[model samples]
Target chain A: MTAEYFMVLGLLGVAFFSVAGALLGYEKSISGFGVVVVATVTALGGGTLRDILLDKPIFWIATPEYLYSTYAAIIATIFFVRYLPHVNNYYFLLVDAIGMALFNIMGIEKALISGTGMVIAITMGITTGIFGGLIRDVICREVPSVMRNEPYASACLAGGLVYAALFTIEVDYIWCILGSLFTTVFLRLGSLHWGWHLTIFRKKDFKNQSD
Target chain B: MTAEYFMVLGLLGVAFFSVAGALLGYEKSISGFGVVVVATVTALGGGTLRDILLDKPIFWIATPEYLYSTYAAIIATIFFVRYLPHVNNYYFLLVDAIGMALFNIMGIEKALISGTGMVIAITMGITTGIFGGLIRDVICREVPSVMRNEPYASACLAGGLVYAALFTIEVDYIWCILGSLFTTVFLRLGSLHWGWHLTIFRKKDFKNQSD
Candidate 1:
């Protein structure tokens, strides 16, 4: 698909994941007010950070559509939560993955367009991919997966590196997007199944620490 | 006090608050990782949001002193948390007040300098004052006081309106800042003492069901 197509899809993914996050928070017994807070963060957190770093008007404030979509998502989650059961968990993962991939692609493109070097571009890509989820977790009072043993950030890193490498080789734009998405999806799924993670610290290191 | 004095004091206040936040977060019963996260947020959160909204280089990154001060604060907190029990709560109120006053004044000034009209300037000032705390509360998994019944945003609104009025009347910049700070501090203190709040919702309002 073209870049523009992916960007629109990404925005939709953000809306979907936001609702999913709210549903999950509701199931976890988070307060109604807390659910709205988490939903807003899950939807707009990444884009807000990206716009701030780029020194641009916030995307949502500039265009009302994002805000409207987020509001709709929140309302939908609040009203429809009781009807759904195990479906939310599966939907959360799917929407999260889509949002992650879309954000990574858009972030890389924006950084490149701003004339950033490969290192900064990749960093921004990874940041955009995971920042919304990080904000969601932080707001839910859970340790952000990125700061823990999860391969969440690692998958973004791999996708970003792939995008950068492909761009360097002057690969076709469509192929680059596909390649990056494939890399992220594979890494994430494999990690989930095989329990893959970065070796940040050994279990022995924290053996003496109280839990 | 002169504008320069206020600026210097504000910076120093930022340093003090950063240290205090880090120390409070590092208490014996607190998780070490959580402490670092909260400390970082409490220290730089307000200024970061202010700079981002103003589209300026982040104040801390532009001047490394902020980072240095935050690190120093963290270290000091770690070593001295046990010695100071009541200090934590008192420090929270004090530093928060100082930060609020300084940031509100600076945000209005910056907006005025950027050629925004009085209304926009007032809005920006109020936003700058509260955005950081909103972020912090969200991260702490609490409903943001601004979104709830707290008079936090209302106090900002009052202060900003007073500042705008003074500026429109061609008052001295010093008087304007003092007037705004006074209005904010008293209103905020009064709110806390009286438990004043603005209820955005009424129980009867929800009876309409999607009107």
Candidate 2:
């Protein structure tokens, strides 16, 4: 039952990720083919990377339905996303947060089930949630917002911790999933609204010392 | 005997790749720790991505010696690369060509070994040859030289086809490796010397055309 639930949410997240990627392409005014390609990569890249790192068969290979879903999302985006006259930040944030949140929870669960430690699970969850977008941003020749100023991975870390804690006590699986999902989504939304940001590291410039 | 030879060359290529990445970090004037991180990622990212896509155990995981090798390369780079005053274009090009050429051959060979088709072998070869540098370029916020020009991926494609054809004809494995490596390295150097470039795809802008 729990596995089925995770599968459904994971699939849904892929659809959201595909649409979000397509939206980025549209915002950048790329070609239609580029849109589809970017969408497909965004939807599958994170989960594929996570699975590969874990030495497991990719989730999409096990169920080709995921590929079909990504295609379907691309088609949907061509009609809807491509026609938008102006960027809709709210819709993008909501969809992106939800999708990444689902992926975060799924990645952590996969790691824990594979007997990985809690810290590793959280790190993997963050990687799954944000790495695809980082790749997308890099491809577009823009600095990744997640890397510079956003609580995106921070939200994933918090939600992953919540999920792991719940699982540790043998709490109900349904609540564990839902609770973590809610935490990430809300955390992201709150950060977006309040302008919360991650502090970045920078090397001290010694040239200034002489002055 | 052939497999073992390829293994040694591929390992040597990884060492070179790691050093080349570290050289890039130094050229960019990043901190020491940041240099090592960037170098490690650039060295391993492509092979890691290839292994994951092929659903094989990551080479570094199977042989932790690769990690130690990366560390050694980092130490070497800190001493050698940091002292270089100007853009050592010759050294960079030579090392990069050798490393990427070897990776191109290995990726194709691994694909063929896994019972994959010819097209996939070529694609994987290109991916393995260029994707690590792609990751490096992205992190450094530069346009990927491969995507833009200089016959980067083109050389890999040519070399991969040569290797595959030679393998198909049951040629001596040593000759196949040397022939392809020479082909890629020469192709890149020729392009560099002659200012050869790849044509990029761009949609015609109607507004610009009218203006």
Candidate 3:
């Protein structure tokens, strides 16, 4: 029953991820098949990448239900966008943060179970959280917002650290999961809400004579 | 002995891939440690991704020599670019094509050995050939050249088909490898030399009022 519940939750999160990705594609003037492609990648790309990097069986391949949710979400999003032409970036950020938070904890748990070190586990967690958006932005030909915009990966990193700390102290695994998820969601949403930004390295930022 | 020889060849190809990736990062004004990261990804990302999708051990993780060559190439290219200010797009295209051609065959061979279908094998071949540069371009905030600039993946597709046809017809594996490599390199180089391009979809291309 728990497994089934998590599966449903995972599929729902994938749907949100698909919609966020579709919105990005819509903004880029990508139409029809392109939006589907973007949405599919956005929803499945992160766990796929994480699984690949960890040399584990791909999640969506093992359970094809995720693909169904992704497709269904894209179709629904397209219709919703047609009626609501003003669908904006804020909506994208909101859903994206939720998905990222969910994936962050999932990644941390997976990495830990895989026997990776804390640092690598944290990195994997962040990779899971942001790679979907990173791939989305990359295909859309924009500097990955993870690198330039607010602290997306940083939020994941912070959450992963919290989870690790809790685990190290012999806390219940369930509490550790909740703590990490709460931390990730809080930081991610806080950044969006307060318009927090991280400074990126720019050519002008360096005053080297060689440059 | 034959496996050792192939290992050396793969590492050499990785070096070239690293240099091409570093040159791209240089062109984009990404300096220092960032170039190393980009070059490493360009050199290892394709094979790593292919292995991951195939649920196999990552090639670079299994063989650290590739990473050494990638780092060595990045350092060499940093020096090469410092003295050569006029390193242009043509140089990038040349090395990139060579590396892509090498990876195309490697991907096809791996996929066939993994017992994937011909079409999926060909798709994997194209993915290996172009994904490194695609990732590089994405990280640099450019539309992937593979998608827009020319017939990059198409060349890999042609080569992969040649390999599949030859294998199906009971051609010697050596001949099949050579045929595929030659076709991919020839088409890729030919496209570069002749300034060939594939037209991409644009807003103006479709006259639909719904658009």
Top candidate by lDDT: 2
Contacts from the true interface found in each model, as a fraction, amount to 0.06, 0.10, 0.13
* Candidate 3 residue pairs that clash: none
RMSD in Å for model 3: 7.6
Q: Give the least accurate 10-residue stretch of model 1 chain A, judged by summed lDDT.
A: A81-90
RMSD of 2: 7.3
Per-model TM-score, in order, reads: 0.58, 0.60, 0.60
Task: Sort every candidate by TM-score, greatest first.
Answer: 2, 3, 1
What are the chain A TM-scores of the candidates, in order? Answer: 0.86, 0.90, 0.87
Q: After superposing candidate 1 on the true structure, give the runs of residues whose Cα lies further than 4 Å from its correct spot.
A: A1-3, A6-10, A85-88, A165-171, A198-211, B1-44, B56-130, B134-211
Candidate 3, residue B137: how far the Cα is off, in Å: 2.3
Compute the lDDT of residue B183 as modeled in candidate 1: 87
Q: For candidate 1, write residues A1-211 as lDDT tens digits.
A: 4656755755775786687677656545553344555676677778778877876776665555666688688878676655443344666666677678778877787788778888898888888888888877765667777877767878888999998888889988888888988898788767777888779668876886745
Q: What is the CAPRI rating of model 3's predicted complex? A: incorrect
Indicate the docking level reached by candidate 2: incorrect
- Give the range where candidate 3 chain B is weakest over 10 consecutive residues by summed lDDT: B29-38
- Give fnat for candidate 2: 0.10
Alpha-carbon runs more than 4 Å astray in model 2: A1-8, A18-45, A52-95, A115-124, A134-144, A147-150, A157-183, A186-211, B8-45, B48-91, B94-98, B114-124, B135-211
lDDT of 2 by residue, A97-184 (tens): 9989999988888888888999999898988888778777777776786766678888998899898888889888888888899999
Error of 2 at B102 (Å): 3.0
